[model samples]
Target: MKATNKTEAQRIAYFGMKKMEKEGGYAFTEGTVSNWFNVVKEQDGTTYGVLLLEKRGVCNCPFWEENSEFGACKHIYWIREELAKEADFQSLTETDPRWLHGGGI
Candidate 1:
């Protein structure tokens, strides 16, 4: 299914977290936040995901501009919430993979 709003996207992220916990040996502490990631806001308002690694925000959201939107990708927004307490998956920005939770802008 497609996430139509922040709330729904959060649920999907939670599912991804659960999967992360079971497979990667870490819990997705960023249920409401993410570590380093990229997001895509579709014309229909749906959001997709990309994990950020190193200093490169690799989210291919159609709205992204390499220089213009430098650090504001949805993946980063996912982990860096305004009210988050800083979680485990929140700092693995250097090891983000290209597959799994990925999409092109």
Candidate 2:
């Protein structure tokens, strides 16, 4: 979903992206389902699952659970941006049996 205002979630996402670029503690993995993704932050080594729905995206991160009304959390935003850059975005969304089990990269 589109965010109308500049919310905290967006700021977090921005910083997260910058951190990923500057440091080396982020990992993202595509899920078996086209809309599913796994996001990992190095600070905590926690894997947050991001699920893209028809109209909105969801994340298992605590920040998202509490502030989802405002917009997607860092994990969701990160995965969405990555997916958008893919040349085969449509095909990537298709079900892939190889990703049936979750793994990080």
Candidate 3:
């Protein structure tokens, strides 16, 4: 909940994306998300504050386009941040699973 900086927030966002992918809850058109994050620029006057407007709906905010709605919504912000963070951590993981269901299910 205390993602006080871009690094922390990015980490969470990555995790959320990963989870969504694994759960089959979302789909993407080949590198769209990658392109979103790839295009980052620092500008004046913003708060979600990092000018991640390019990655808008990357967060699951129900009120994003409603005039900076989710930007001020801490819960929504945190959810995305947490997901990002977790995904970042997961990328460093090694491929070693015993397959609890006897196959990679």
TM-score of each model, in listed order: 0.28, 0.61, 0.30
The 10-residue segment with the lowest total lDDT in model 3 = 37-46
By lDDT, rank the candidates, best first.
2, 1, 3
- Which lDDT tens digits does candidate 2 get at residues 6-98? 565688767866666677677788889987888877689889898988767888878777777865676776676667655443444325543
Write the residue-wise lDDT of candidate 1 on 1-84 in tens digits: 345554555455456544533453222222244543323333344444555555544444443333223434434444444225
Model 3, 10-101: lDDT tens digits are: 45555644554455423222234442322111243222322244445443343233324224333244444545655655554355352333
Q: After superposition, how far is residue 65 of candidate 3 from its true place, in Å?
A: 10
| C-alpha lDDT (0 to 100) for residue 81 of candidate 2 | 68
How far residue 64's Cα lies from its native spot in candidate 2, in Å, is: 0.5
Give per-residue lDDT, candidate 2, residue 50.
Answer: 89
Q: List per-candidate RMSD values in Å.
A: 14.5, 8.7, 11.8
Give the clashing residue pairs of candidate 2, or none: none
Task: Kindly report which residue stretches of model 2 are placed more than 4 angstroms away from their true locations once superposed.
Answer: 1-6, 42-44, 88-105
- Which is the better candidate, 2 or 3, if ranked by lDDT? 2
State which candidate has the highest TM-score: 2
